[model samples]
Target chain A: MEVAAFYGFSALAILAALFILFSKNLIYGAFALLLAFLGIAALFVLAGADFLGVAQIMIYVGGILVLLMFGIMLTQRASQQDGPSRHNRVEVPITRRLWGFAIGIGIVGVLAKIIFSANFRMSGDAVSRKSTIKTIGVELMTSHLLPFEIAAILLLVALIGAAYLALNRNPAQ
Target chain B: MSAISIYHYLIVAAILFATGLAVAITKRHFVGILLGIELMLNAVNLNLVAFSRYDSDRLSGQLFALFVMVVAAAEVTVALAIVLRVYGHFKTVDPDKLDELKR
Candidate 1:
C-alpha cells in the first residue's frame, strides 16, 4: 500500500509537470500545476510530514496557483483577430524533445545509483511516526521564533510591494 | 527491504526538477518561466521533506521546507506584480520580444 501510494503520487506529480510543459495554453498549464502541487503535498504526507502536506495544499495550491492564473489572464492579448496565434502558445514547437527534462532525470538517476544508494536507515534512531502538527507548532514558537518573525515581515513587504506595483495603470490616466 | 525508500523519493524529485528545467527553458512567455521555477522549488521541497524523515524528531528538514515555502509565496507575489507591471509597460509578456531596455 505504501509503495503503491508513493509511486502513484510520484507519477501524478511528474505527469502534471509534463502537462504544464507541453500544454501551450497558460490557463490549462496553471490548472495542471495545481495537480502537481497536490501530488507534492500527498508525497509529503506519505513521507510522514503531515502538517507540511496540508500547508502545501493551503499555500501552493491556494495562494500561488491563484496568483499564477491571475498573471496569465491579466496579460492576455486583447487583439480582435482570432486564430491559433492568440491561444497562449509558448515557444516550444510541438516537435520539441523536452531533452533538458529527460537529461535532468537521467543525471539524477545515475548519481543516486553511484554516489548514494539511500537504502539503509539508522535502525536504532528511527523515530516513531506520529502527527507532526504539535511538533511543528512547538518548534515554530520556540527555536524557530526568530525565522518565523522574519518570514512574517517578508510576507508583509511582499504584499505591500505587490499592491503598490499593481495599483497604477495607464500613465495618461 | 521496505517497499519504498529514499531512493524512490529522490528519483521522483529528479524527474520533477528536470521537467521544471525543461519547462523553464522551452517556454518563451515570462509566466511560463515562473511556472517552471515554481516546479523546481517544489521538487527541492520534496527532497527536503523526504530526507526529513531521518530527523523526524527534530523535524529539521520539514522546518527548512517550511521556510522555503514561505519564500516561494513571497517570491510569487513580487514576481506576478513585476509581470503585471512589465505587461503594462511593454504590452507584451514574451521575454524574447522585449529586447530593448526602453520603449
Candidate 2:
C-alpha cells in the first residue's frame, strides 16, 4: 500500500511537471504547477516528513502559486489577436529544445546510474519510523538556532525588497 | 512486495531535477523558468528528506529542507517582483527578447 501510494504520487508530480513543460498557455502551466506542488507534498508525507509536507502545501500551494497566478494575470497584454502567437511566445526554438532534451536525458541517465548503483544504509524496521517534526523543531531551536534566525531575517529583507520593487514601478523613482 | 526504498525517492528526485533543468533552459518566459527553479528546489528537498530518513539518525536533512523551502519562497518573491518590473519596462517576460542589457 505504501509503495503504491508513493508511485502514484510520484507519477502525478512528474506528469504535472511535463504538462507545465509542454503547455503553450502560461495559465495552464501555472495550474499544473499547483498539481505538481501537491504531488510533492504527498511525497514528503510518504517520506515521513509530515511537518515539511504541510509546510510545502501551505507555502507552495497556498502562497507561491497564488503569487505566480497573480503575476501571470497582471502581465497579460490586452491584445485582441485570435491566433496562437500570444501563447506561442512561451515555446522555445526547435534547436534549443533539441539541445535541451539531449542534455537533460544525458544528465538523468548518469544520475540514475549513480543513484541506483550506490549503497544506501537503510533501516527497514517499521518500529523505528517516526514523525520528524519534533526532532526538526528541537534542532532548529538549539543547534541550528543561528541559521534559523538568519532565515527569518532573510525573509524579512526579501519581503521589503519585493514590496519596494513592485510598488515603485517607475524606474526613475 | 518490497518497501519503497530510499533509491525510489532518489530516482524520482533525479527525474524532477532533469525535467526542471530542461524547463529552465528551454522556456522562453521568465515565469516558466521560475517554475522550473521551483521544481528543482523541490527535488533537492526530497533528496534531503530521503537521506535524513535513511542515512542519518538526526533530523538534519529535514531541518535543511525547511531552510531550503524558506529560501525558495524568498527567491520566488524577489524574482516575481523583478519579472513584474521587467514587464513594465520591456512589456514582455520572454528572456530572449530582453536583450537591452546586451547592448
Candidate 3:
C-alpha cells in the first residue's frame, strides 16, 4: 500500500512538473507548479518527513505561488494585442535549445552515476520522531536561533522592500 | 527494486532540474525565467529533505532546507517587485528586448 502511494504521488509530481515546463500560459504554468509542490509534499509524507511535507505545502504552494500569481496579474496587461508581443519575440535566435538539453542531460548522467554507486542505507525510523512540531520549535529557539531570527528579519525586509518598490511612482509624470 | 528508493528521489530531482534548465533557456518572459529558477530551487530543497530523511544526520539537511525556503521566498518577493518596476518602465518583461542593459 505504501509503495503504491509512493509511486502514485511520484508520478503526479513528475506530471505536474512537466506541465509547468510545457504550459503556454504563464498562469497555467504557475498553477501547475502549485500542483507539483503539493505532489512533492505528498512524496515527503511517503518518505516519512511529515513536518517537511507540511512545510512544503504551506510555504511553496500556499505562499510563494500566490505571490507569483499576483505578480503575473499585476504585470501582464490582459489585452489581445499584447498576445502577439510574446510570440513575435520568440522568433529571435538566442542560445540553441539542443545545447541546453545536452548539458542538462550530461549533468544528470554524471550525478546519477555518482549517486547510484553509493551504498546508502536508510537510517532510524522517522515515524518514531514524535512531536515533530514541538521538537522543531525547541530547535528553532535554541540551536537554530540565529538563523531563525535572521530568516525573520530577512522576511520583514523583503516585505517592506516589495511594498516600497511597488508603491514608488515616477516624479516626472 | 520492490519499493521506491532514495534513487527514485534523486531521479525526480534530476528530471526537475533538467526541466528548469530548459525553461530558463527557452522562456523569453522574465517571470517565466523566475519560475524556472524557483523550480530549480525546489529541486535542491527536495534533495536536501530526502537526504535528511535517509541519513541519521540529525535533521541538519532539513534545517538547511528550511533556510533555503526562507531565502527563496525573499528572493521571489524582491524579484517580482523588480519585474513589476521593469514592466512599468519598459512596458514588457520580455528578456530579448531588455537590450538597454546589454553592451
Chain B vs. true chain B: TM-score for each candidate? 0.94, 0.92, 0.90
True contacts kept of each: 0.73, 0.70, 0.50
Q: What TM-score, computed on C-alpha atoms, does each candidate reach?
A: 0.90, 0.92, 0.87
lDDT at A152, model 3: 95
Model 2 DockQ (Cα-based): 0.65
- Identify the candidate with maximal DockQ: 2
Residue pairs with clashing backbones, model 2: none
Question: What is the docking quality class of candidate 2?
Answer: medium
lDDT per prediction? Answer: 0.85, 0.86, 0.76
List candidate 2 stretches off by more than 4 Å. A83-89, A122-128, A171-173, B55-57
Per residue, candidate 2 scores C-alpha lDDT tens digits across A1-173 of: 88889999999999998888777778888899899999999998888888999999999999999998888887777673577666424767999899879888998999999997888665543222666767787788889999999999999999999999888657586
| Clashing residue pairs for model 1 | none
- Per-residue CA lDDT of model 1 for B1-103, tens digit only, reads 3457777888788878878888887788889999999999999999898788877667888999999999999999999999999999989888878878676
Between candidates 2 and 3, the TM-score winner: 2
Off by over 4 Å in 1: A93-128, B101-103
Candidate closer to the true structure by TM-score (higher is better), 1 or 2? 2
Quick one: best TM-score, which candidate? Answer: 2
